[model samples]
Every structure is written in structure tokens, then in C-alpha cells.
Target: MNVAADPAPAARPLDISTFREGGSLNARLRQMHEGLLERVPAVDRIACALYDAGEDLLKTFIDSTRTGHSLEGHEFRLSQSRSLSRLATSGDVRILDDIPALVQHGEVHSDWLLEQGYQSSMTVPLFDNGALLGMTFFDARASHAFPPVAQRDLLLYANLINMSISSELAALRTVVASAQMAREFAHLRDFETGAHLERMARYARAIARAIAPRHALGDEFIEHVFLFAPLHDVGKIGIPDRILLKAGRLEPDERQVMQTHVELGLEIVERIIGDFGLRHLPDSSVLRNIVGGHHEKMNGTGYPKGLAGAAIPLEARIVSTADIFDALTTRRPYKQAWTTAEAVAEMRRMAVAGELDPECVEAVAAFAPRIEEIRARYPDED
Candidate 1:
């Protein structure tokens, strides 16, 4: 097949630095598409579809030239388009020389493209480590514009793009896995026996969602808070084994040492970010406030930090209620789990005595039934 020559200057060597770790995936994909378009001339339109392996379909993730365009948000079933579908399913690059022939043969979805002024096009399937990841389509208004040389270059660029995406996915997976391991280690320490890190994370998320409306907490913040909640007790890692594993109540000195866990947790997170060189680092102050100040009394008697009232971060406040509520309702070696009614009464008392944030306590009270449902949904980890 004679694909159109790359009208732009020779493509630059792929730079790994162009692909950054620890950023929003959607933003990264959009940036990658724009970068590709700039390097590949004769490409007036670019549409990127990310394959959903579970769904067995290509969902358009980025469409750069979508205004008055027919290809925007187009869903192409793997069973419908013989050429492009086969390319995606088999992880092959398909260069079409005769667009009209393919359309007539039922291999191309051209009705919409024809209306949008797209003529000849090249479809390059993106794959990483033997798995199909997605496909990129470049189209122009002129028919039979792409040649074999251009097709080869496009395929090479597509492979480069796939490599970049694969690296990003690997980095994200590492972050998630590290977070999980940290949570498991923490669960072995204390807070709630039989209740694992996953349950606490979910509870924190539920509470955040419940309070989001009143506090104007954005969805992204709520999501981050949920994931970060598991790390609230990570500072316990720094506490001496005796204090951390102690089976009985602690003396004032021991209690002070134990309270240092808050600072320890913040330091641990800071170290993790530093080790990974993740930029922006999610404002450790908020997380530190939550991890350290969650135990603080509303009256300024809390340990590690005497932050009181509105001085505490809202995410920390939400997590404080969730963590305490979960602790109260779950059995532990030091104490038997209180009945739901008893737990509610204690929370109410705390609220009245100004030991806890009134609004947070009220939010937990309203979420009581939903909290029970969450507990039921995720039984204590065995």
C-alpha cells in the first residue's frame, strides 16, 4: 500500500522525558495525542481509542478535531469493521490504500467520515507487552494520500506511544501496590481487629462523600482522601515495637511516644514522594493534619498537634469521624465492639461535649444506616 508521505520534517527521536510519571492519565493522553499530531504532517485529524479488554471494544478517549466532526465519541464494535477491528483485535497496523473499496466491502465506517470530509486514513494498533492497548487513526481530506513509507513511520510512532503509556500504567500500579502493602502492615498493628485497611478506606470514602455537599469538597479531593486515609496510621511504623504491639493501656510517657505516630506517618509519606520524585505531592499538610490531628479533641486537647476547631483540615475531620466510628463498632483485643446504638450515643455525647466537630459528628450520625450497609458489604477481613 502506498501511504501518503510524512509531509512534516523528520520525526524526532522519542524522548522518555516527554512522558512524566504521577500525573492525571487523561491529561497525559491528551498531551501525547497533541505531541504526535505536531510531529506527523499531512494528518489533519487524529482520533485515539483506548481498548477496553473486558468490554472488547474501543472507546474514543481523545479526539483532537471534534468540532463538527463525525468521528468524535464514535464507538466501533470489534465485530463490525473488518479491517480496523481486526487490526485492534490482532494488534496489527492496517494501512488502507483504497478507502472507497473498504467502505464498499463493509470494512470501514465511512458514512459519518464522508459527511465530515475525511478521506484516506491510517489505523495503527497500539500494543504493550503483547497486549492490545488501543488504536490511533490519522485522516486527511485527500483520497489515497498515505503511502507505505508513511504507514511504517506511523506504526513506529504508535509503538513509541504505546511504550510511554505502558510505563505510566506500571508507575501507577506501583503506587497502588505500595499503598496496599502499607495498609496491610498498619492493620496488623491496631485500630480495629478483624477490620482490615480496605474497610477503613471505604468507610472514609463514604463519609467524605456524605459530607461533600456541605463542605464543597471536590470529587478529586474526596478520592485522594479515601486512598490517603489508609496511610493515616503509617507513622506507627516508626514507633517502637513495644509501644506499637503493647496489649494494654499506656502510661503518659508511652502515650506521648505513641502519639508521635502522627508525625511518623507524615514523614513516611514525604519520604515516599521524595523517593519517587512525584511533583506536587498532594499537599502533605492536609494529609499530615488528618493523620496527626484526627485524634485531637475539638477543645484543643488532642495529641501530637493541639489543632482545634476549624484549624484541622476537613478531610482529616471526615477521616477522624470515620476512623473513630469504625473503631467503636469493631471488636479489638483491648475492648469489645460497642453496639451500634451505644456507639451512636457516645458520638452524640462527644458532639455535645465539644470533643468532636459538631458538623462532622452530625454527618456521621446521618450516615449511620449507610455505614452499617458498608460494613455489611465489606465484612471484616479474615
Candidate 2:
């Protein structure tokens, strides 16, 4: 394989910062494709396809030039095209200067390409740690469009494309893994109902949105708070059932044991981070903070670290408000659920007493109307 560095005059170095990490994967992929097309004037179309390892098929991910019949969501077996398969396996860039040769040889998928007026094409393999992830196809109307000069630039562009895709893939895997962990932890507790989790997390998001400006929080941060909020009490699984499932108020020692759930939740999530090799992800800290610090108060009165006021993680503050709101409004074995008015009045009292973040409490108070909708949507079985 020819891996010559591009010696041509730099065509305004690729500004990868333009590809927003917070955007959807498809949007980022399209942005990269458009950037590549703007730089490489000879290429007419760029299509990125992902290899579905389970099915042994390459499915279309996104297409830059959807001219002749959209191949979006189209799939083809990897074994059907020998050249492409070779490129996929060998991690080589296949520059087909002639398309008719493959057509005359009855190569799979070639006839379709020819019918679409693509005379020549190039396939750049995308790999992550030696595993073939997929391929990006650059098609042109002219033959021999990808000569040595073009190949150098193409290879450079391919590297950029690989990084963009791989990062998004990693992000996707992290999201799935985090959700799976939350679900598994919730399952460990018989009392951890899904409806409660859903309601509380949304409440967290709402509070985050309200205080976002003051705290300089972005949409991504708010999203992480919502995603990780449900795991706030995940550590309860570690407490003995005698304490965790006790129907009545506990003794001081038993209450202390229950409070240890905060530390236990942090440890559980820390283990998950290590086990999944996601310790490098900054977003993972959101989970840890919520699990460990939600109990912390604004006046240095809460448990665990006794973090007070701004010392508490912003995410934990938001989850703290949401969790309290849900707990106050939802019926438990020990107490009857408070009415909306009663819950709001009591929350205001807590905020005044400095047990809760006043700003977060205000935010939740402002979003009070949505709470009923969420509650109705995820009502208890009774």
C-alpha cells in the first residue's frame, strides 16, 4: 500500500473543531464528508458504510451525494466484492481507475455503481485497533481521479475520517454501557421502580436547564446529569435488606448504615468505570457525583463528604433536588405521597432552611407543571 505524505501546498488544514461532539453521529459524519468534498474537488460522491459484524453486512451510514437513488440504509454482503473485501481486511485504500473491468468481470455491486455514472472510485478502510470498522467510498465521474497526488490527500482525509467515526463509536458504546449499568443496578433493588427513576431523571434535567446559565452548563452537561441521575440510590443494593427494606424509620446505627449507600454507590460505579475501561471519560464522573454527593446539603449538614454549598458537584445538586422532589411526591411504604401543592410548599421550606440548593429548588418549582405530566406518564402500579 502506498502511504506517501501529502507534499502539495496545504489546502487550509482541516478544521476538525467544526465537527461538534455534541451533535448526532450522522450530522458529524456528514460534516466530515462535506469538508472532504470541499477539499477534494475531483470526488463527486462520498458514502460511509458501517460493517455489521453480527450479520456480515455493510450497511450505508450516510451519503454525501445522494444523486442517483439514495442508497441510505442499503446493505450488501462483505464477501460479494472481493476488492472491497480485500480493502476491508488488509486495511488498504483501493483505487479503481477503471470501473468497467469490474463490471465486465460481473463483480457484485459494480453494475449498480456503473449505472449511477461512477466511472472510477476509491475505498478507504476505517479501522479501530486493527479491527475493520467500515469503509468510506469516494466516487468520481472521471477515470483515474485518484492519482498519486490525490491519493496522498485522500489518505490524510481518511485518517481524519477514521478518528471522527471512532470517537463517535466510542461515545455510543459509552452511552449504551452506562444505560445498561443503570438498569442492572436498578434491578438489584426490588423497590427501585422504573417509573420513579424516569420521573426523577427528568426532574434533574429540568433543574439543570433552569440553572444552566448561572452555572455555565451546556446541553451536554445537562444531558449527562439526566442520564446519570437515576443511579443516585444505586448503592442501596449494598445495604442489608434489614436496613434497606425496613418499613419503619431506622435506629441511628441503621440510619448510618443506610447513609453508607452514598459511598457504596460511588464504589459500585467506580468499579463499573474500571471494568468497562471508561475511566477516561469525563462524563463518568457525573454518575459518581450523583451517586455519592446527592445527600450533601447546602449548609454542610449532609452526609458522606459533608460537601457544603458550591463544594457539591453541580450534577449532584441537581439530582439532589430531583430525588427529594420525587421522594416527597411519591408514596412509599412509610408515608403517603404528598399532593403537588404540599410537595412544593415543603420543598420551599427546605430551600429556605438551606438543606437544598435554593436555585435548583427554584428551577424545579418553575418547572412544576411538567412534573404532573411526568408523574401521569409513569404512575405507580397501584
Candidate 3:
């Protein structure tokens, strides 16, 4: 009787949270895709294209495509397509059962779908609260594959995916906005510094994209760097007003105190992360690395930590180059703005001297035209 009673086996619990994880949005979306396939096998791709209202741009952000042909690094203005603008504005959900029929619309997206062999597509606008975020797309290889039943599942998955993207982005916006507010409250936000932060964000993004191929960096990493670049100097708020706002050169001892901002910045970031309950926010480490390691020289001659070369996080290396490039090209209280040529030459010299990452310096140099354009767009205090 005892032996017979020992024969019972436990049933494994049913699992459902497939996309819940602390990782890149792309990875989470792929996880969701895998889970969706279990119920709706016809769904071939799940993708999100994000909107940037500043430039009226909708750009490919992440995707999980079984076909392996994804539309990355592609962007178009939201106003360029009447159908898309209408959908985004009116919150209309689009179900194109015959994608080829859409070719007559002359939309680049329609043309791309045809070229990619996507036969059926469902598109819907994603929103955070009342504001439009972007669009979520469900594509299938077979026409009319998204039947009413499949449409119900796709809509549910779209909301799940949007919750993840919108929540993560909202967390990031909180961190950035809170830090900027602190700077503003402390009287540390000025026209020059504000403009510098704006330009640094773009410059960091340019360098990240330029070197992405060699580094295997994805769009997620690029976006985080762009968002966090400006916060690199946010810790200067901790230093004494005498030192931070000094009109003249810092003395050796004062310079030592000024250099403490790196650690100070890291502390500020950590405190913000903890206070906001964002300990698990994906890529939070990117912000920490930018604040902590941006000052460490490649030759081990730089600040708080003696991290050198590849020991420095790649994001930090990228931001350091961007920060230095902006500093060199921006007119400072103590120095005049250097020409773009002069800044690149100096960065090249610094790279050779092991003061900066060579690849990053080269990235900045390679992105000079864009750098000039950014400068023209967000020029230092006129």
C-alpha cells in the first residue's frame, strides 16, 4: 500500500508570463512572439515602430520576425502617409488582408511589405495614457491569416507589448526628467549647458550608430545612450557653487574636489534609481556606466576608477568621446569654441595618447558632417 501511494507524480504548473523579464525590449518582444505562436501559429512577425514627435518621425524600434528580414534603421515622417497619419490621429486599427492591394496607396511601408512578402498585416496605434507613442504591427505570410479569432489574440498581445514599451520608456523619462529638474532647481541648468546636453545626446547617438556594426550593438543600446548622455554631468550639482561656478581655473585641491563628481554622479544616479523603485529597469546599468566610467581614461590616467581600454564599458567610451567632442566644440567660460576640424584632430591626438578610445574618436571623426549639422541645429548660446 505504501509503495503504491509513492507512485503519484506532481503536475507541472501552467506557465503564462512569457514576456515578463528584465532585458531589452526586443528580447521581450521575441519572447512574446514565441508565446503567441503557441496559440496563433499564422502570425509571422510582431514589430513596434516608435514615434518621435520632436521630428514627426516614426522609426523601426524592435521586431521578432521568423523570416529574419527585419526593417531596422528605417524611419519616415508621420505626416508623409495619409493613412498612417489618420490611423495615428484617429486611433483606427488597420487590418490589411490584401497587402498587395495597398501598393496603389504608394506608401513606402506598403512597398516594403510587398518586397518582404508579408501578405496580411494588422496595424494599430500604441499609446501611453492619452498620448500616442507609435504603432504595433502584426504581419503574416498568408493573406487573410488574421481572422476574427486571430485578430482578438493579436490585439491582446499588442496591448501587452505596448505596456512593456510604454512602462519602460516612462521609467526612463522619469529618471531623465527628475535629474533635469534637480539641475534646474540647483541653478545648474543654463542655456549653454542645456544646449550642450542636447547636442551631446545626438552626438552620442551618432557615434553609437556609426560603430554599431563592429560592436554588435542594437537599437535599444543606441536609444539608451542618446537618452543618458546629457546626464553625464548631472553630478556637478553636488560640488560647491564656488568650484562648479568658478570664473577662473581650479586650483590643484579644487580640481580634486571637482573630479569627485564622477563618483558623486554615480551616487546620484543610484539614489534616483532606488528612490524611483527602478532597480530592475532594463539597461539601467548603461546610465550607471556613463556616470561612473566616462571619466576613466583608456590609459588608466583618468578619474575615480583607473579602468583602462576595454575595461571601460562601451557606452561609457562612446559618451566620453561625445562629451569631449562637445566640450571642445562648445564655447566654454574659459575657452573659445574649437572648429570641428580642430576638435577631431585633438581627439585623434588624445586617442593616440591613450586618453580616449580610438574607435570612439574615429566614430566622432567619421560623424563630422552630422556633428556639424547638430551643432547648427542646437548651436551654443549665440
Candidate 4:
């Protein structure tokens, strides 16, 4: 009998369940990445990129890396890449047993992966319902690390991650859709155009990016701020059409009624969270703060709560600044469209008058080039 009995693998003590944290998808991804490294030492990185169909683009969302740098700020259009487009179309798993074998393509993402010393990789297309949402990537330092059995393990993890992302986005869509329905039900004329929302989101992103470093904020924090910023005015659905639609300045009493929108927004947000069972949505306070506190001022003078200085959440402060900037620069029935320079001067004045956050105003000023680009991309309706 020449059959040599197989020796059992060494006993280990890595328990993934122990690292579980509630509520944050980003936090969960980090925990999963750490657990993956402990279970399979050769696997070195896990990352996700979210798709934006409106722009035909995919941007980095979250990642967990072991001895690898994050590709946090990377973005590319789906229309421009053959490989990613194929993945988007097929929604199949892609395996690269040897990453260096594909380096001849000269793609920026591949070049970066190669430079980072990853030798093998797997890419999974993520979806919510029938629509493509984004992609998840796993990279390894060792060639042929993701063989059949190992790939089965990786696939299970991929599905878990994709579900987390899908759940988060679906819950968010519910809130936004609810707000839209509320507006239509009340016959609230939708002055907040799709273009306005797009511009404001970008402005919020720029401000959040600038302030993040100084505040030790992660890309996920900036991501949440951008995600929730557009919903800041959802409460205006509760405002009366006369005050809301007035082509002239709001009268004193009308202004006071208009100020109630912030409170209304918070109520709508809370209702959506409760009714739809979205209480577990990650970073929900960010949503509440943006909607409930955006109108608060720095000098204890503004609306519903008069939250002065640091009492106002920084996310709200950022949104308010972005909102004001867009309102000033865009053409509205009640106000003339101010030039970029004129708007900047006015914002500076507002900051000095203690009506706006000075730091947020200054942060936005740092991105003058991007401001012009966003405006050009999302212009007002004729």
C-alpha cells in the first residue's frame, strides 16, 4: 500500500463573524477584507466601483486592501472601455490568472494594478434587480491564487458585498422617490430641476473633498455627503405653492412659513426611514442632518433651529453653501443670474455676515475650474 495519507492543514483561529459591525457597508467591507486576508493570505485586495448611468461612468466607492494602495478617486466612462463594457453587458465573472499577461492593453487601471505588484485578479459585475450597478474587484499577489475551489469562496464573498451595496442604494432610492411622490401629490411645481440637483451634488462633492482632509474624514464620509446633499430640500414639498412659487421676495410671514420646510424635510426623511423599514440604512444621520439642518445659520439668526457655529453639522454647512452658490449663479424667476465672480463675492459677504460657513465658502473657492465645468454640464432650462 503505497498511498500516502494527506496531512491536514494547520489549525487556525480566524473567525470572520467576530469582526462584524452593524449598519455601515463601508465598515463591513473593511472587516470582510481583513477577514479574507486572515483566511487566504495570498488574497491582497478587495474593491468596488459604482456605476453612474446618467454619465456613463463608474467611480470608486469603497475598498479594503492588505498591503495595497486604494484606487479611491479613479473614474472612467463605460463607453470608453471595451473590457468594462463587456463585463457590464454580460454581468459575468472575469478571472485573470496572471494579471501581467494582459498588460499590453495599456489601460490606466490595469497599469496601476500591475505597478502595485498584483499578479492575479477576479472582477465581478454587481447589480440591483435587472440593472447593472457597478463592479467588485479582487486582486492577489500570487499567480493562480483563485483556482476553482478558491474562486467559489471568493464568489460567495462577492455576492455578500454586492447585496450590501444593492440594499443601501435601494433604501436611498425609496427616500428620494417618496419625496418626488409627495411633491406631485401636493401639486408642488418642481422648480428643483434634475440639472439643479446634479450641479448641487457636484458642488457638495467639491466642498466635501476640500474639507475632508482637514477633518480626517474618509472618502466614504465624502461619498455619503454627496449622496445625501441633493435631498436637503425634500421638505419643501410641504410648503404652500404661493410662498414656494412666488416670483418675488417672500414676505416676512411667508418667509417664516417657508422656513418650516427644514422641519418638514426632517419629518419626511424620518417617515421614509420608518415606513419603509430603512432604519438600518448606513449613515442615515447624514441624511437627517442634511435635510434638517441645511437652513441653520452660523450666527444664530437663520431658520427653524438657529443652530449657530459648530452646532450645525458640517455636512449641513457644506450643503447650504453649495445650495446658496448654485442658487446665486443660476437664473431664477425671482433673482437675476449673477456672474461667477459676483456670486463668489456675495458668498464671501455672507460668510462675513455670519450667515454662511466661512471654511466651506473658502473650500469651494479652491475649485473654481471645476465650478465652471459643472455649470456647463448642467445648465438651466430655457
Candidate 5:
């Protein structure tokens, strides 16, 4: 084995400027992928596989070389792939100089390389504090392309990629914390309990995960719903205390006034976007969907915009079930807490009656024990 050489001056210096400004991990990775191709013409393909440690699987998440290649959803068991498992444990960059030699030797790694039509390749493991996070692959069609010098430079790039992931995660936590503060502000004036918010968010995530396969939802979408669900009732902060805190059931006029909370929520989100100057960001459609359409019903009788089934955003639909289920199970000023069986039964009835999304309701029901655990964990203060 040839000793790996140091990074050459010709190799593009790993850029950390974007990391300082808190750029997204996915965006930075894409730039690195493109940069690798531009910096080394020998690189015919570049891909990233994120490790799902909890599931002991690897997912091909990002690929610049194979656009629309159906590799987005591909997953592999780490236990089954000896070469990949070795790479994970060793944390060393594997430089395959001759693909045909490995193939002739009946190697599994060669089988995979030959499938992708590559003659030479380099696999660099991405690690953070000794734990394997993922790996980046650089493939070429020409032999002896991934020399020792190339491996060294790619190793530097992989380290930068790991740092980028950490930065992105820190940024995401900041965003989530700020959003949670907004929810807490609303909770001060509304009937929402912290436990309610916690349980509802979990339920929303469960529903999203269950429907991900059928609706083509990804892990990112599921995470967004989980993070944004707590803000579904954020607009209630704008409602008048007399109406929001009424002891009895709301009157006709009071109900109409209460319904404006949805609109108020949208306005609040817009003003927040403006205040923070985040308007130019990839946009606030996710927040708007949860705030604006969470109350919309399937039969078009729901308010604010009266969006019917399919017209309502799926994110909102998922939250709707979560919010309603929590509301029914938790005691409020005007109503006592219903039993688990009672709440689930009523939600099931609403699903059958076309009032709630049946699929979402089913998903929530399927995770009943998890929901109960959340409720127990975050019980209301005495």
C-alpha cells in the first residue's frame, strides 16, 4: 500500500466561510460535490451515504453524478457489506486502483463498483469524535486515478464535510429553540399545556413517518412536522383574553372571533419573517402551512380559507389529528379530560365521518402507547 501524501496546493482549499454564516449541511455538501468534480477531472462520480446508526443501515442521501438515478431511497445493511463495515470501523480512505483485479478476485466491493461502471474509486469515511456519521465516495472510469495524493485531498474535504454537518446541526437547534420560545409565549395566554404540545408534536411525527412511504415524504419532511407542530396554535396569543379564556362554551360571535386565530397566526408568522429578515430564505411555506391550514377540514366546512381535502397541506393535515387528539385527551377550562379509549374512539368516528384525515387518524392510533408515554412524561403542573 502506497503511503497517503499530504494535500497538494492545487487542491481547492476546504472552504469554511459558509460554515461561519451557518449554511445548511445539504447545501454545503452539494457545493463540495461540485467542487470535487471541478477540481479533479478524473472524478466521474461523487456520492454521500449517511449512516443510520440506530437502524444499522446506510442510506445514499446525496449524489451529484447520478441525477434522478433512483438512488435517493436506497438503503443497505452495514452488517451485510463487509467492505463498508470495514471502512466504518477503520475510518481509513480505501483507494481502489484497479476495479478489474478486485472483480477477478470475487470481492464484494468490486461487484458494487462494477455495477456503477467505475474502474477506480476512493471511499473516505466521515467521522465526528470517533463515531461514524457517513462516508463520501469518489469514483472514476480511468484506472490509477485515485492516487495517494488524491486520497489525501479527499480526506481533507471529508473532514470539512463533517464540520459542516456539526455547524448545520447547531443552526437547526437554534431555529428549533427560537420556534419553541414562540410557542411558549402563546402558551402563557392559551389553554395549551407544555405536555399537550410535546405529545402533539410526537403524534404528528408518528403520522408523518407512517405515511412517508405512501406520500413520498422523507426524513426531512418528518422532522419539519415534528418541529413545527407546536406552533399550530401560536396565533392564539393575539386573541383577546375575554374570548380565549372564556369559562363556558363560546358564543356565535365569540366563535367567529376565535376562528380568526388561524389568520392571526399567518400574519404573526409573516411579521416574524419580516422582522428577522428571513423573507429571502427558502421561504416560510412550512410555517404557513401548519398555522394556516391546521384547522381546515376534509369536507370544506373548516375555516379561514375553507380548504378541503387534498387542498390542505399534508403537514397541516398531520398536525390537525395530533392537535385534536391531544385536546380531547387533555382537560381544559370548558371540558374535562376524556379517557384514552374515549378520545381515540371519537377521533376514529371523525375519521369515518369525513371530518378528519382517516389515514392520519389511523397512524396516530397505531402509536397509541408512544402517545401515552409522552403524555405521562410531560404531565401538566399541579
Candidate 6:
């Protein structure tokens, strides 16, 4: 009948500074596990079971203190133990001094308890707000009762752990959603140029990596360039079919209309930025800059904003070279595909004329063999 003693009033609130620092969820959970072990000295073994509400399964996720005993094949089924199931279903805490008695009374699994040599155990349900999340199990080998104070301290700790788990899940969901959107963006048929987008994106990453060290573009910059490259032609979604899908060379007026795709792409990207509220997100502005300025040329002849030199973002400059190289090297309805050698010669010509950034052109030339590999990797649409 003895219960664990209550913890001090000051210990009521669990310290959650580690969770706030922002890293992987599993790492944070492991830290919480270690913290609990350090705080509870008397407990010989601890096993945490998280109830996946969606799957309706109780899984042992964290285990820390088994020295002599092995729990390699132990199964703690929710349906097998009436007491544990009751605690989980009813959201209550049970502290037991006589573990064998509870099993004999049909509260827990008697055979399972004896096999593990568990004399005493504590089970506390984890919850956030009103919903049940999971439970924490604290066990000892000797027959010792939990004090009321200890029960209260364990409950508080369990609640803090549950809150941290929920927050981490939310962050993971955000990342997954962002990735799905990126995938959808990649598949859009706006460019209508048949794998031109994929080739150009690869080229963009290569150019960015080549120029990164010399231009002081850090790793973060290079990574963003790779991700944002696919969106270079995103504005083509807004261009009229007559301009976007044009098979023949465009007249002066038609060319002007086709040129509006860059502006359209910028506008579409800006709208996405506003909708996602990603303007303040780390490196988001850099991504947006790439989307908006990828078509700008080194010379003043580029469309939309007509940015020149360093006025164009570094990402955009890298993408511009990639986009043109892919365009020249790939077959279009209007022109036959150029050979790798021909593409390199054309790029060199542009570099010498200062129409394209010389560093990016050189990078493309250096990676010329890979360019053929890339073309083979993503074949043109027949």
C-alpha cells in the first residue's frame, strides 16, 4: 500500500532547455532519457513505451538501464495486461510495491513479471492537454514501494517528455510537407522543353559548386542553388501557350511576349513566398532571388529586370549559364542538339565576349565530361 513520496515543489516543472535548442527529435528524446536516469538513482531499469495513436500500437522506443538482464526479445503487449491497458485507456498512474501480487490479481502478466525478476514497478500515462500520448515504465529488482513524492515527480517528467515529442513531430511534419511541395514543383510541365529543366538544374549546382570557393559562396549557398535551380522556368507556367509552346522562331512581338515568362516566374514565386510566410526563413530570400533573377545575363540584354554583373544574385548567375548550356546542348523543335564539344565552344565564345560569367563558363568546361554524363542521365523527350 506504500506509495512514492512527492518531489519538491521546485521540481514540479521539468526543465526543457534541450528541446528548445532545436536538433533532431530522437536526439532530444535520448537526452531526456539520460536526464531521467540521472535524476532517478534508485531505479535499476527504465523502458519508455510510446503509444502511436494513429497505429494503436505501444512500442518500446527508449531503453537505458539494463545491466545484467537482457530485454532482447521481451514483448509488452497492450492487450495482454489489463492493468497497463486500463492505465493507458483511462490515463492514470499506477505505483506498485508488490509486482507479483498485481499480476496474480489479473492486473498485469504474472509469468512475464517473474521471468524478468521485477519486484516493483511504476507505470505513468503520458498526455498532452486531454489526449493520451504514451507511458513510462520504471522498474527495480528489489521489493521496494514507490513514495508518493516520487510518483508526482515522475508524472511531471512524463508530461514534459510528451510535450517535447509532440513539438518534434510537428517540425518533422513541416519538413515533409515542404519536400512534397518541392517534388510537385519539379514535375510541373510549364517549361514544355522535355527534361531541359532537369539538365539545367544539375548544371546550376555544378556551376555554383565551382564558383563557391572563389566567390565566397558558402556551403549553404551552394545547397540552396541546387534546390532552387528547378524553379528557374517556374514563370513559364503563366506564359501564353502561343509563346511557351511555340515550335517555330518567334517574331519580334512574339519574342517580347515570350520574354514575359521571367516576370511571370518571379511573380509566381513571390506569391508562394507570401503564402508560405517564408520570406524571413533562413536562406529563403536567397532562394527567391534565384527564382527571380536566373534568366538575367551578364550583358545588359537579359529580360524582365535586365540586371547586369553583380546586380544579379550569384545563384541566378550560375543558373543562367546552366540554362543556356542545357538549351544549346539539347535538341529543340527549332534547332538540332549541339555536341558536347560544340556546347563547350559556344560557352567559351560567350565567356570571352563577357555575355556569360567567365568563371561559370570555365566551371562548365572543367566539368565538360560530366555534362555528357548528365545529358545521358536525363535523355531528351522524343
Best by TM-score: 3
- Deviating ranges (above 4 Å) for candidate 3: 1-16, 104-108
Q: Which ten residues in a row have the lowest lDDT in candidate 3?
A: 7-16
Model 6 misplaced regions, further than 4 Å: 1-194
lDDT of each: 0.65, 0.76, 0.85, 0.82, 0.73, 0.65
Query: How do these models rank on TM-score, best leading?
Result: 3, 4, 5, 2, 1, 6
Per-residue C-alpha lDDT of model 3 across residues 1-382, encoded as one tens digit per residue: 3455434334322223766776788988888787778778888988898887755778778899998488776678899988889999898789999888755556788888898899899998999887889999999889998998888878888888888889889899899999999888878975337888888888888888889889888777788898898898888888888888888889999999999989889999999999999998878999999999889899999888898889999999999899899989988766899999999999999999999999988888887876776777776665
| Predicted candidate 5 versus true structure: per-residue lDDT over 1-382, tens digit per residue | 8988856556655554543343334555556666666556687767777675644767665555642232344556677777878999988778888887765544444566787678888888887668887877778888898777777777777677667654444344455466567766656424777777777887787788778789987554565577678888778877888999788889999999999999888887777766666554332576789999998999888888888899999999999998999889888765799977888899989987878999998887787777666677678775
Ranking by lDDT: 3, 4, 2, 5, 6, 1
The per-residue C-alpha lDDT of model 2 at residue 270 equals: 78
Name model 4 segments beyond 4 Å from true.
1-21, 104-106
RMSD of 6: 14.7
**Ten contiguous residues minimizing lDDT sum, candidate 5:** 66-75
Candidate 4 lDDT for residue 107: 74
Estimate the TM-score of every prediction.
0.57, 0.59, 0.88, 0.87, 0.65, 0.53
TM-score between model 6 and native: 0.53
Residue-by-residue lDDT tens digits, candidate 2, 324-367: 89989999877899987788888889988989988988888798
Model 2 misplaced regions, further than 4 Å: 1-9, 12-188
In Å, residue 336's CA in model 3 sits off its true spot by: 3.8
Model 4: pairs clashing at backbone N, Cα or C within 3 Å: none
Model 6: weakest 10-residue lDDT segment is 67-76
lDDT (C-alpha) at residue 224 in model 1 = 62
Which candidate do you rate higher for lDDT, 2 or 6? 2
Write candidate 1's Cα lDDT for 125-201 as tens digits. 87767777777777776677677766766666566566765665454345545645665675643543434455666
Give per-residue lDDT, candidate 5, residue 16. 48
